[model samples]
Target: MADIAVSTRGLVKIYSNTVKALDGVSINVNHGEIFAVLGPNGAGKTTLMRILTTQLRPTSGEAYVLGYNVVSDGDKVRRFIGYVPQEFSVWTDLSGYENLLIYAKIYGVPRHEINERINEVLRFMDLSDASKRLVRTYSGGMIRRLEIATALLIEPEILFLDEPTIGLDPAARKMVWDKLTALNKELGLTIFFNSHYMDEVEMYADRLVILNKGKVVVEGAADELKRSVGGEVVELTVDDMSKTVHRVNEMNSLGIRDVNIDNDRGIVRVIVDNAEEALPVIITTLRDAGVRIIKASISRPTLDDVFLKYVGGKISEEGRLQEVRTLRSVIKKG
Candidate 1:
């Protein structure tokens, strides 16, 4: 759809000391569609979000939300957009109704319609029953629902949620997800968000973009990308890799692309054109080699594989290395 709702061209942001947070990131989100940005911690997802919400200015390039420059017309942009940060923002010391009433006054809602609007939003958020209850008594999920309700007070054209379901239990996360889905489907609010949870994005987003170290690695629908693997992945664990490797080499006649060794685990990963058809030959070869098989599994490509495919051989390997170094130090100290 040519209805471009959010557009950024060469968007770059550097810190006060010139540490680049966003590096020439450009993306377009269509109107009335759900778009998700996926990344690990410190991958610049929050930084990009802050720039869009007008909390931080970009160091270079331009960003537009609802056809207005984020820097020049920030007030106008804020009027049409609602942002829910990762942290809990609602005043915990006040009652549900009290917070909304105060926000109504701050936003300058019409004096006569304030009551009607407040009541309508409270009911929609399922907080009408707890309207008078102090926020300290509300559950985490309820508070998040109330936060979303407040964001909707201005009838925003777009909603940006950053890790919206973080810190909630599984059931609470699902409830938040269901409510978000309802808003997107019934009201057609253009939802934009970032989350580390893959399953959540798979469920709620119509489209997704994965970012690694400040750049989009891939962008597309969940199902399409999951099913796009050109070959099957077979993971085999063996007691004697040397024997297994020799036998697996015989299957090269079966149209195999590559056979990789997992020396640490005494396993092998075989990638073939048609995994199902080659299974009999593969099994026959392994049995003939007198190798003991520990475990074997076949799987279609997943979002994890997609991430590794585009990102590189070692996706998020930096964190793993850090953990290894930390563990080594702990062991040495002990």
Candidate 2:
């Protein structure tokens, strides 16, 4: 328990007696590790982050951050942790240096050490050259880094980031993650984040928990979760969907139990123990069955595949939009 950075027991959050925002959720995150809470839109990721950050209360159950109870010991918990919410929390009218300075003063950093801390955070966030520029003038990624730098001015033991890289371009997202990774490694700071980006979670999170409809559906290291869904995925683009489906059905005899056929795209995705060994045999079988293969590739199972297995769907942009519509409908009915 002492080594655990965060722990929750049967957590639940109900909104207006109609919606169960969190349903008996429980998880543990180890110290000095980057832990990710992942889920689709409206999956209570934000609710959980707010609860852990002492901004919201759970209807039932308990949450501890760095061994401090989030509810009863919120003040102590605040002292030990920093939080960056989904929205940009910065003074856009003020310079980056001024923003950090204000935060340092608010966090009660010693007057003598305020400038030193500001300079340190600016350098760490790679914003030293732009420290005197108004935050409004910064790029989206730079604004995010500035926000993070403000959070770090307090030198908290753990950091909580909610959708930290949500709307940035690929390059900007990578830059933000680079700083986070460095902070975790160099300072041994425990980082807990809520993210929908599977690739980012796969790359940075030491472990992750996937929540759906207010409950955890799966939790593990990225590789462990991927393996749980099965092994490598052998994808083939075939010219004849019917013949390919028939030949793939025969693959069941070869111990390949998980096979998916996308007739629309003429893609066959097969889950096997080893794709490298299975690909040749599969191609030969298809060829012998008079099936023409247009293209074939083998890839290890991805986090998106893991999500699809547990959530029963892809968490794409369209899925997020659907979630929003569904939530609105429920709220209207309530």
Candidate 3:
């Protein structure tokens, strides 16, 4: 087995002369590692996924999946990788067992191994009881797991999952993550998947590739990415009659990460590299400026802070992390 499972150099893909699905993209996924590509909708994640699965050809540049060129050796490449598409690709009318049997036969899985593989995967998914149930009758989350189990039937060397838990509830999402982790760690399988949930990725990915507008923004360990945020946010409530703008700029000039204000609420949000060193300074600075401070504190930089820096940063939106909002602006709490 190769140390690098997938490698791309200056990969480019264009369609309809107006959209750049993937452009100048380069990335590496190490063998036996879980690499996650996370991005919002229409950010070219699907484009890259399609190309990697050898279903679509790139406009230019080169990509290799499992030592086989994605374009030239697509058949060989497809054999070694199993992909669970975002859409439900299995036959809903068929039972889980029937669906897996058809795929195994199509993949040329040896007849002797088919029964064992199907049984093993069904048990692995904790869906042995539902093996005979119609896929259409299964819940959204259970169907998702069945899809993954179908991919695992081939015992593929590399697995690619796209938004595997998109519509799943918390418990099902966690069960899927736990299964992926077991496969990646205990079984030493290389898994490449895409998702928008920071909490989910933070749990499973050994490394991450973040994409924005058909381009990769950053790739690194989660801790290092979070460390880049540096410090905590000091949320200050100001009751000054007229000194808000002057105060916000003054705080921003201190090499602080950012400054945001809820003008409607008189709260100034400050991001600093070192919260301990900066929070007292801000409190004293504002007091010295004759501004009254209602409150001040320091905290941790969450995964959304990282997302806001990389994904939302490209769109020029205020990284206001609240709870349970749109996927692009994830719900990050203080």
For model 2, residues 87-154, the per-residue Cα lDDT tens digits are: 98998999999999889989999999999999999999999999989888999999999989989988
List, residue by residue over 1-334, the lDDT tens digit for candidate 1. Answer: 2498899998888765335567788898999999999877766799899999999999999999998999999988988888899998799999998888888788778899988988988887788999999999999999999998888888788999999998899999988888888888899899999998877887788888887767777778877766554477777888877677677777668877656664445567677777888777787778777877778888665665555556543445574355446546666666
| Ranking of models by lDDT | 2, 1, 3
Worst 10 residues of 1 by lDDT: 312-321
TM-score of each: 0.84, 0.88, 0.84
When sorted by TM-score, best at the front, the candidate numbers are 2, 3, 1
lDDT tens digits by residue: candidate 3, 1-334: 6899999999998764445678799999999989899877666787898999998899998999988999989989978888999988899999999999999999899999999999999999889999998998998878988999989877889999988888889998888888888988888889999888888888788889888767898998778887886577766777873475467566665668766554445566577877778877787887888888887766687666677666655352232221113332332321
lDDT at residue 60 of model 2 (Cα atoms): 99
Q: Give the TM-score of candidate 1.
A: 0.84
The candidate that achieves the highest TM-score relative to the unseen native structure: 2
Q: Which has the better lDDT: candidate 2, or candidate 3?
A: 2
